[model samples]
Target: MAEEKLLEIKDLHVTVDGTEVLKGVSLSVGEGEIHALFGPNGSGKTTLLNTVIGFARYHVTQGSIWFKGQDITNATIDERARLGVGISFQRPPTIRGVTLRSLISFSSPSLTDEEIERTAERLDAREFLDREINAGLSGGEMKRTEMLQIILQSPDFVCLDEPESGVDLENMALIGKAARIALGRDSFDGAGCRSIKSRRADYKAGLVITHTGQIMDHIFVDKGHVLMNGEIVCSGNAAELLGEIRSHGYTECFRCAGCAGRRA
Candidate 1:
């Protein structure tokens, strides 16, 4: 039997500001599988994620994006959000007038104050809760803020961009824990030991874009793909592909992916 696909993109072409950024890209993430996307800077990795959730400026010129058997090629961002699609941006914006506390209510209206405070503490965001959303936050803090939203809302499909970037070792563990919570997985063992299973077993389906693949150290990566020149050029074992890219660089990915035509 084949795995159930939760998110599917077929020959997806996207144009941003009149420039074609994603050219005929296609991929599928299985239900409960965490897939990692890798690429060099400006390779359309972010474009792919933004387009999936209907980022306004990115016009889908061709193909279709389907979530859980529904075509969302023309769905509005809010429409997609209502369908349980959540994304944590690499750089989130600051909403000067809106406090994170209020924004949490917007994301999960029924969440109690106790639940909010506990997640805040788990993400080291107790102080940030009262601050304006993303206002004066460090990169790590911004990432944590986004994670907090995703956790409270419990989105079915999570899109993460570089959750490990700018995060210290201590904080990386916390971010990983938050990711687990968002995915509805066990974060701790019975004896109070953090689960060695953070990167394994039950998980929600989603795609993650990783520059350093450091997030893979914390979350389970079932498969990995390399995107080059706006197309997915390679796919393989998550950890193994990450290791290959680390040792030989992305040129190795192009060579191995049989994408020599795009290398120049």
Candidate 2:
């Protein structure tokens, strides 16, 4: 039996600032599967993520986006969040008045104070919970805090943009572990491992965008796609694709003639 698809992007064409960024991009992520997206800078990688999360600036001029079989192409960000879609931006904004603890609670109202505290502690972020969200924090600190909120949000589908962009090795490891927990994989205490079928039934899925592929060392990714010139050119095993991209660069992907009009 095959797993149900959690996210489907079909022929997506997005425009930002009056210029098209995503050109007919399409990809599908099955429940319990984590897909890695690799592309050079300015390849519309972030544009695709922002568009999926329903950012207004990323206008969808054509195509559709579906979540859990529901058409969410025109859904508002709040509506999408309520439907269990959460995203961690590459460069999140700072809210001077709101503390991290407050934002985490707001992200998931059902989470108890103790539960939030435990998650923060697990991420080694207990000390910063009372501080303003993303205000005056170091690069690694910001990434870890973002991961903590993501875990607390506990969304069924997670879209992480460059989670390992500026973090150090130690912080990257912590972020990776928290990411696994958010996706219903292993937890911080080294337990809570679930089978792929079980995870799928629970609707846990993730799509991570990375340039260095360092995060792949910590979290398990089912597949990878190369996005260049605003289109996915190759799709295959995550590790293998990463290796090829590392060895020959994205120029190697041009040989495949792009994944146009085909589902990943």
Candidate 3:
């Protein structure tokens, strides 16, 4: 049986600030699956995520992006958000005046104050709720807040960039818990108490970019793709691919015709 694809990109070409960053890139993330994207620095990993989320500066010169059977190649960021697409940025900027609690409230208005408090408690973020958005936050704190926003938004598909970057093992575990809830891998109120088997059909989908592969310790990744020099040159089992990359750097991928042939 074939998996139902939730997000698809066909031969995507994107440029940032008039310089091409992605070249003929293509991939699909299926319903209830999480795909890890592995690449070296400046390998267009972040570029791909920004493009998928409809960031203005990432101009798509060719190809199409489809979500839930609709072509959204030219959709605005707000339109993408409305269509159940969300992103957790690698380095989220600080918003000087907006309180984190107020922002979360705005994003998910139906949840009562108590419900918000409980959710914050689950992420170990109750103390930071009153702080200004992304202001004076440690790397781990910012990542946890990103997960909290994703959980509250409850998007059908999400793109997370470096969720484990710059965080210690302790906070990494918390981020993982929040991610599981966001992806419906665990029940919202009871993080690890319930089985996802009962809710498999409606589980959220995700694409996560990782340079270190440490995020794998927290979440299940069904597949992986390696992007190099603006093109995807490898695709395979997430853990195995990570192992190979760790043993031999990205240069080894160039020798494997089977992996590099994926784009051909």
lDDT of each: 0.83, 0.85, 0.87
Q: Rank candidates by lDDT, best first.
A: 3, 2, 1
Candidate with better TM-score, 1 vs 3: 3
- Kindly list the per-residue Cα lDDT of model 1 for residues 1-264, writing each as its tens digit: 887788999999999999999989888888888889999999999999999888899999899999989999999998999998999888888899999999998878999999899878877888999999998888788878888888888788999888887788878888887776676564423222135334433467778999888777767788888998888878878787787788789877557643434332
**Best-performing candidate as measured by lDDT:** 3
lDDT of 3 by residue, 152-241 (tens): 888999899999887898777778777777778876556362455565667789999998888888788998999999998888888878
Which stretch of 10 consecutive residues in model 2 shows the poorest summed lDDT?
Answer: 254-263
Indicate whether candidate 1 or candidate 3 has the larger lDDT: 3
Which residue pairs in model 3 clash with each other?
A: none
**Predicted structure 2: lDDT:** 0.85
Selected candidate, larger TM-score, 2 vs 3:
3
Q: Which stretches of candidate 1 lie over 4 Å from their true place?
A: 188-202, 257-264
- Which residue pairs of candidate 1 clash? 199-220
User: Of the pair 1 and 2, which is ahead by lDDT?
Assistant: 2
Span of 10 residues, lowest total lDDT, candidate 1 = 188-197
TM-score of 2: 0.92
